[model samples]
Target: MMKKTISLLLMLCVIRSFSQDTTQQIMPGRQNAIHQQDKPYVILISADGFRSDFAKKYQAKNLIALGEQGVVADYMQPSFPSLTFPNHYTIVTGLYPAHHGLVDNSFYDRKRQQTYGMQDKKMVADPYWYGGTPLWVLAEQQQMIAASFYWVASEAPIQQLPPTYHYFYNEKISIDQRIETVKEWLALPRDKRPHFISFYFPEVDHAAHSFGPDSKETAEAVQFVDESIGKLQKVAAASGLPVNFVFVADHGMAKVDQQNTIPYPTIDTALFTINSGSAVLQLYAKDKNSILPFYENLKKNAVDYDVYLKSTMPASLHYSTDDDRYNRIGDIILLARLPKVFNRGGRPTGPGKHGFDPHYPDMRASFQAWGPAFKKGLQIQGFENIHVYPLIAEILGLQYDATKIDGKLETLKKIINTK
Candidate 1:
């Protein structure tokens, strides 16, 4: 069995995508709530840059065991523009970036002179840039306790309800310490313990950025995170917590050499400032005409990347849901094909990066669930990450307000088991 898993991973590595597609599909509509199971605690773990096959490729025993013992999907397709902040929030809000405002890892708000950037501590905490209610906030509003050790948007008070035990985003915090804190949280009495908790680990992502996704460093990073998961499992066992688990990744990494990139000067900088880069980039243009020079260049020249006016971006990406979305996304969007990366005025690419079109097979994220609320040993078809919110809401028995969300729980019925 291990040999077969390894063989499958090797094939996935070659294709840079995993998961077999199935014709089984479900369509649950908006503003609809699925039946909730009472009081089953949930722990959501987001391992950034964790490719669909990274666990099997590196022999992550604990995670593999959980998948074998629980409900597992072929994969989880990330929302389009498969960037970190956008997709992580998408998981919690059940809304695409078009509806929930974290349009990219970086975006600008003219009125507030605010920059919704991943690296900006202030911007990350500002509520104006975030839309919809994250799972933690919704859980808290329904008289249930919630917490986030390090999920995106956990640092802010979205819809004015912060998670009961939220922590500010700090990359310096070690994974061991984060797990220890969660162990303590889980050990609390049932009433005092958070009903919903989120944890994030960036070792895999950080290492993959420095060493290519195919490099030994990424494998080592995977092992490190896997061992951490082993420890977390032990802690959960010790606490005797009745928590369900959902392990996920914001998006998968694709290999691209840092040393080989097209010079940024090749694009006309005067017309638009490059707001993001790598497999995907968002452009904030000075004006619509300012974008024409490069628009014509991509059309006239055989370029490696695809360019689109925000309004004309492939409808499949769902980036331009409405006419007013342009202000958040800017006038143009750029997508880089695999093996090709954009160099933003000498911005270096590392061994790997994500933010590609989420539809690409390799760019798909990981999704596995185990415990009371999920079926055991069931491998179902992959679905969009947006549906996660409804699942979490159902587990907590949360009566959430879903004004701006796109996620629907009925579509994911195969994975959910009852109380």
Candidate 2:
């Protein structure tokens, strides 16, 4: 009896481990349509917190070489309040953060009367919180197979469909193993292969957040991503398919005044609920009548930051009341000026942070693409990240209603080789 009990406990441990790290979540009974088998392949890669100048600054040889072989943009401008989840989802959906409903990394939804946070696993995977048609969803709706190693909203069933091939977000898998899986996907039969794939790397972002962006640790992390991309490209080339690569970053990083962090302003709990971040803060008023009084008081005493109501926000940001399609933008918003951030918990703040105004030079993102379909040795001017969606859709011959999306095909059409 003792021996049997011990065996049962070991088996239970194995089951729990498998449940936590289920590497692949595939939607069976799905295959690429016959016409899609001949379509071009695009592997969209996002290296988090990889600043616009990181490649040249860190001497990322592989990415530099890839840019020379194909097309390179001066920089990619992320949407306003450039947080990770919002900008990433914007890139895939071709909508501004406000229009797509992911207003911030963590935000309150008035309709649900609930908070959506990046750390909340249930909220992260819940489809109801996400809006806009993600690239994977768009492809699958058209009968094309799509895969994702990991991308924001990829695990969620947006439009009642997740990617045909995807994985729950986890860090346990080695980079080598992940690359091997991509190779395996490409090697599958024509109908079973995925034409559009998304891959993400979080090492640079992690290192930069813990250590300053200029720290040696952050530099090493950049090199790691550079080397990993080099390996992925080499393995992908061996697949004998006309695979295209679009390398991008969600947003850049900046060093802040960690020693002199700003503490959250005092407010009555009964009147308002607060969602705060290092770079931005939002106050949701429980009573609409109480908003102006608090806004006026905060504005009078505000320091090292700027405050704005949804109706009064700068139009250039595309993040005002008119843009808040899902009503997730706070009743009152606060944005910290550069070199300073808010610390609501009074904890030691990290030196490196993002979620700043996108117009700042440090907030710019990186964009590079190389493949058979692109014009070789061409360098282009900087453009908004939203334009990327239409570019990818055009290359893959995927149809989308241009009227609904903010991206315009003409913005990036010049980069592709039509002849």
Candidate 3:
């Protein structure tokens, strides 16, 4: 009994050590410069895997109401190979995944001889893995205060600068508590309050992956997010700040064929290293001389997928060798057809998946904006997600080098209320 008790205690200690941290992290001695004290507030919220049509299909009443008060896009086009980390980073940096160096959720960087996966906390937090000046980094560079409740790469001190007020990503904090924290930030003194804040929700993505995008569980998760946003808005209003809210999703979820999953194509392991995804697979050649032969073989045997050399990828994707600034993209790319996904080693797979080409309707993501800075009762055509960085930057009056980022402010400038 004593031995068992000691083992249980040890397990409890381990769990505590690894458990999510709910503490608010703040950078000391930081304040909004006097010039930024009067700037408008922008709260950027991302609901991962929230599809463009989910509000209407799942009857997200609160979101519908919010849309009626602001601008709604028909859909938001995610960058190529739509995935969470890549798209989220793309939205903030206004650069495509390849240009931003996040190329995929899981990718091997030949230069660093390192692999970056979303689940690897150390890799995810390493600033070396990221590129491009994120909006928060831009804001802080200009002495504007920024904060993040949760966002991709928010924990990383990119450019050696993190948001003035932030929290490490964790789900242990209840929705109410999260909203309350936002309220607290807004209630801070003029110079200490963050003018730009980012918030994120992972519930919808989690449910969709586990129970399929159309399942009741996914709908429930959507509703929860919808209600949570409503609460956040109410609290912000109570703070009496003109908070502009921009809601988006990294990518949409698709109900995929869980049974009879696609098998990994046979490859000579000696010559290649593989990074596999549900809808995409990348093979890095050990020798440049071996690439063409292996690629030709894969192309000939490719079934239910399309294979391409890095240079031959469609120009629209902006993911070809010309766009691979960091050399993070694989030498050979394999894109899985819809409803089919690669399941290596016959591992258990989820019913819902993404990371497909963004051109597919099922891969389009959500976008909505409301509050004082937006034109009311407006609906617009779909735009690429990169434009979002400029939108938020414009709203907060944050200056950025237009030449350094891909987003053009003109793409979203018309939606801002000039009057």
Candidate 4:
């Protein structure tokens, strides 16, 4: 009873503090609104599964030049539950997965009594699953054009508004086509072009999964992506338009040995729904009270991973949420201890996986931006990925509903030029 009381108190305190904060009003340092004719343009791209070191390790020329010419972070750390959909949204919305109600790339929403997983197209497009407003949504509200190649929550009309040039998520679109489309968007008259745009390339991530992160195939994919960057720049220069470019990755990858799969055949699978993430696992008990007893026994047989209850999750991850508002978060989360695979559910054991502890060095994402808005040759150490939202907002002078967000404008302002 005492422990329960303490946990409840802590949760309430967190809620109360968030409610009373400064997020209810407009931010103070917003720059002057963009003039209709010379509106600043920002193109943000995600190189799926691209690790931070691939630039230096593989000598990726265009990427290295972008870093040298503008602001580049040593790395951009991903939010907790470092899966693709969640972290991608976090980068645009400045909210952690828990706060945004995307507790997992796949999970059951207790409030709606429905399951939301990325695999189901209807569920993926369901607006209810996406709680926060992404950059594209807000961009439309401001009467500025925004386009998306493929972005989470972009297909749906979030807050009853979608990007002006949005399309359904299609990962198979060739990289050359993706580049050409964005160039075509920019080549349009200034008023017709998107003030903010996004592109997603899945080849690096796909190749890393099919082949280990260290394999020659993954290297080839990395090289191809670098060449594609050159193509994008060539098209942009040809169009005679001034643009800002920001490149990032959802999260890094880690190799999961297929030969050593840890299938937990002994546990009674009936007690809970085990959502296997390959590198991580989430457990939702049929009876909430049964969790404590199950954990006791489960700990006795535990190997190669650490288990965490909702209330006991690391404070740094910022993953705890008010269950009354949404209960999609797991009752128990299992994080694999480095380079281990706990594949009890017989899921596909791809050579590479993410969704581990965000603090893990291997799970760190990448961030680099080059344009007139940024300071030339500015390089800084790694920072959290959530800060990207405010940086985008600042560059475009966007006004959002958030009075307070996880992303701090001040933290990113150092990279901006004052004059």
Tell me the whole-model lDDT of each prediction, alpha carbons only: 0.76, 0.91, 0.92, 0.78
Q: TM-scores of all models?
A: 0.86, 0.95, 0.95, 0.88
RMSD in Å for model 2: 4.4
Tens-digit lDDT track of model 1 for 1-419: 99999997876563332112211111112111222223778889999989888888888888999899888788899987788998999999998887787788887765665556686665566687887788887876666777787788886778777777766665556777778888877776655667788988888888888887888888998998888878887887787657888899999988775676755435467666767567766667666677777676765663777777776888778887383342587666777777778787776557687888888877888999888788888988888999999888877777765555688878676677754
Error of 4 at 372 (Å): 0.8
Model 3 weakest lDDT span, ten residues long:
11-20
**Alpha-carbon shift of residue 263 in model 2 (angstroms):** 1.0
Q: Per-residue lDDT for 355 in model 1? A: 87
lDDT of 2 by residue, 1-419 (tens): 99999998986775455337756888999999999999999999999999999999999999999999999998999998799999999999999999889999999999999999987655677899888899999899999999999999997899988999998888888999999989999998999999999999999999999998899999999999999999989978999899999999999999999988889988888999999698889999999999999899989999999999989999988999999999999999999999899997689988899998988888899999999999999999999999999999999999999988888999999999996
Per-residue CA lDDT of candidate 3, range 277-372, in tens?
989999998888999998998889888899999999999999999999999999999999998999998998999999999999999999999999
lDDT of 4: 0.78
Give the TM-score (vs. native) of candidate 4. 0.88
Candidate 2 error regions (>4 Å): 1-19
Off by over 4 Å in 4: 1-37, 265-270, 321-325, 345-348
Candidate 1 to native Cα RMSD, angstroms: 13.0
Per-residue alpha-carbon lDDT of candidate 4 for residues 1-419, written as tens digits (9 for 90 to 100): 99999998986775454334322111122222346447677889899999888777778889998789898899999998888988999898988888777777888777786777787665666688887778987777677778887788876678977777766665445677678788878876766677788888888899988997888888988888899887987877777766888999999988876877766525456778767577667777778878898777767777887777877778888875453136777787777777787776576777888888888888888899988888999889999998899899888878875565678887888998786
